[model samples]
Target: MIILYHPRATRPRSRRLPLAVLALAAALEGKEQYEIVDGNLEDDPTARILELIARHKIELLGVSAMPGPQMVAAMETSREIRRLHPHVPICWGGYFPSIYPDAALNARYVDFVVRGQGEDTLLELLDALRGNRSLDSVKGLSYKDMFGLRHDNGERPMKGPDEFPWSPFHRLPVEKYLGPSFFGKRTAVHHASIGCPFNCSFCGVHAAYGNKEKMESPERTVAILTHLVECYGADSVQFYDMNFFLREDHARELCDRMAHLNLRWWCEARVDIMSRYSDETFAAIKRAGCAMIFFGAESGSDWVLEEMQKGITTQQTLEIARRTRQFGIIPEFSFVIGNPNDPDRDTRETLRFIRKIKRINPDSEIIIQHYTPTPQPHDAGGEMYGKIEVPFPDSPAGWAAKEWMNFTLRIDTNAPWLKRRTKKLIDNFEIVVGSRWPTVQDIRAPRWSRIFLQVLSAWRYALHFYNFPFELHLANQFISLRKPKRESL
Candidate 1:
């Protein structure tokens, strides 16, 4: 038996499909007995995973991870696994591994790495383990021979979306991954496309998947979506496309197919796509079950956008937001505030633009994150990485360590008044990073007012609950009521 995993984050509470690992499992289905462990959703995940490995007599473990905090957690899990069982092979795949394969393979905790797409490479690695097959046969793989010189088979072919089979949905922990959805319990994440052609300076995608874009046939997309709705009773979907509208005609055709699925879905796209597509197409998108769309309108300052090589102007972004709202689709944006040129000025401009957006469209949602200046080697040019005196992290371990060290610029606002306030009010208290600003709901408030707030919350929940079809809504409640008793009794 084999075990594939999505390692836990620093402290993960939300789960999603470990798509890469599950894809491998799908390919090896009839050949092996395998189970996927999602550390994010499972309790005491590392311990549970260790227990499962021992019980199943598992020989190899695979983990797929992105960079940043998730990579840190993955290393923590793998280090623990290696400490207890040194002989078991632990393979690394996904974002950090693909871009920094040599560094990943050199790490004490990682025995092997599968770069690019892992489906075929991983299966071949398993074949090598089963019989004494030479590792040299596998493409897009990196590892050290007994002599300890690393070999990376640099020539790997790219495969299209149609080449891989559908996701093994039965292995997913669906209900446990419940995200914020207005109309459903089971949230299905589907993708109609893979890869993006954009060269935004800060993005690592161009390195991971390369610049060529591919779209799954609209028929393939509809079939996958239908399985989610018919098999799991999913009322909502989150499309995992990097740029959902890379090709305007295909996007419209995709939306046309989506209209009959009876699913409420959301997707991410660039602002340039909004201007590129006609208003009627957006109306078609909204009618075809897309209630919300997220745009990467990173900064309100044109200079920062230009610095980031984002390619779109502030006027273009604002106009895109206006058009999105005009079509009755909720417009959401992802923003980054701190950059070198004028950190405080940039943040203020962002807040001003968000305030303006809210004034025009009160329900629009925006998330603003403080920028950390650590550069990615893949996206780093001499103009950016070389010009800065701060050294780039040479290894994944160094990158993880640098996150806590003073190498990157954090808290860039050096204003005296703000510093005093940060020390006195914010820093003195543990304000969680990226948490929503709190509103007043004091326990000391008068009893009647507290009661009113409780009633208001109930009213809001009721509104969300009533959004679904009556029969489907009743079925969900019935299932929920039965689920607890079956377990408790």
Candidate 2:
């Protein structure tokens, strides 16, 4: 028996489908006896995993992990499993291991790190364990040999979604994952594409899946979503595609079919690419229930954009803001503050630009993140890699440390280049803007509290005084405003 574990990454209310583990399970379907145990649903995931191992003759334990809180939970659970069941092999796959394979392998509990895409790699690894193939033959694998020497078996070429079997939704408690969101009452999530074509410096998509993206056919995509709608009563969907909008024809065709499903959806797209989309396509998208588009408007300065190797220009971001408003779809602009060269100027310019965006489109949502560097090839991250002063931790335990956890979440990154004053300014501004325009995604905040926050923060916003919004901060303690970046799974 094989066990696939999805460590708790978000709150139960914020949990979506564990697509990563589901993808791995899809490969093992019919051929292997396996079960998926989601940590989000369990109060004591480690005990549950140990119970399963004790009950069944488990061959391997596969874990899907991400950065931040998930890594911490995964480490603790894996450590306990190793101590209790010394014979059971533990393997980790996902962004955490893909980005830092060596660090993942550094943990004595983790016997293997399936880097990059894991569907094929995992199956091969299982075969090797059964003596059907040599361990060295498994591409996209990092593992310690019998002599305790680590070896990386290089990268595997990414495959189209069509190449793999559909996710075994029947194996999951589908209703538990269907939750309320800004889109609809019962919202579902789907990843219709594999990887992203663009190679943004700050993003880990390129490192995980390379710059090549293969999308499922619109027919197959619509079919799967139709199943979710008809069988599971999913009224809305949010595509987890790294880059959802690629080709105009693909968008138009997908939208054409999606119009019949009646799903109010949200997705991430490139500002430059969407800028070139036709007005007819935009109308089709809106008609098909495209409520919001999350664009990576990383910085306001053109030089910073070039430095990050972001192909979109500041002008394109502004133009898209205007265009998205015309279509009545909200454009959620996310900015990465604190550039390596000059953080203060970057923060100031980006804040000013965010204000401009709000002025142009009152419904536009702004998400602010500190610039935290990830492990990437120098060329992929541009010259910014050389500018980072702090070295990344060499082990999973070190990464699970409090400061590094904050760094992973990009919440309170104490990077060498960032000043405390600058971080304070960003926080104060975030509070003011978030209060001034309470997020529509926030279903938890009471209507009265939203009105109260807006009324309280109006003067500060109008006066352009973002410093020390103590009242708003204090109000938030009671309101507990939901940040979509953190809440949205």
lDDT score, residue 155, model 2? 80
Where model 2 places Cα greater than 4 Å from the true spot, the runs are 377-383
**Cα lDDT tens digits for candidate 1, 311-406:** 888877787778877888776676756555566676667656765665576546565444544334233331341144334455567756754332
Model 2: lDDT to the true structure: 0.89
**Please, what are the lDDT tens digits per residue for candidate 2 over residues 1-489?**
999999999888878899999999999999899999998888888888888997999999999989888888999999999998989999999998888887889899999999888999988998999999999999999899878898888789999999999999999889999999888989999999887778677887887877888999999999999999999999999999978989889999999998999999999999999999999999999999999999999999998998888888999999999999999999899988889789899999999999999989999998888887776622322234446546778789999988888888877888778899998998899889999998988876779999999999999999999887889989989898888767642
What's the lDDT for residue 59 in model 2?
93
Model 2 per-residue lDDT at 105 = 91
Question: Which candidate number maximizes TM-score?
Answer: 2
State the weakest 10-residue window (summed lDDT) of model 1.
428-437
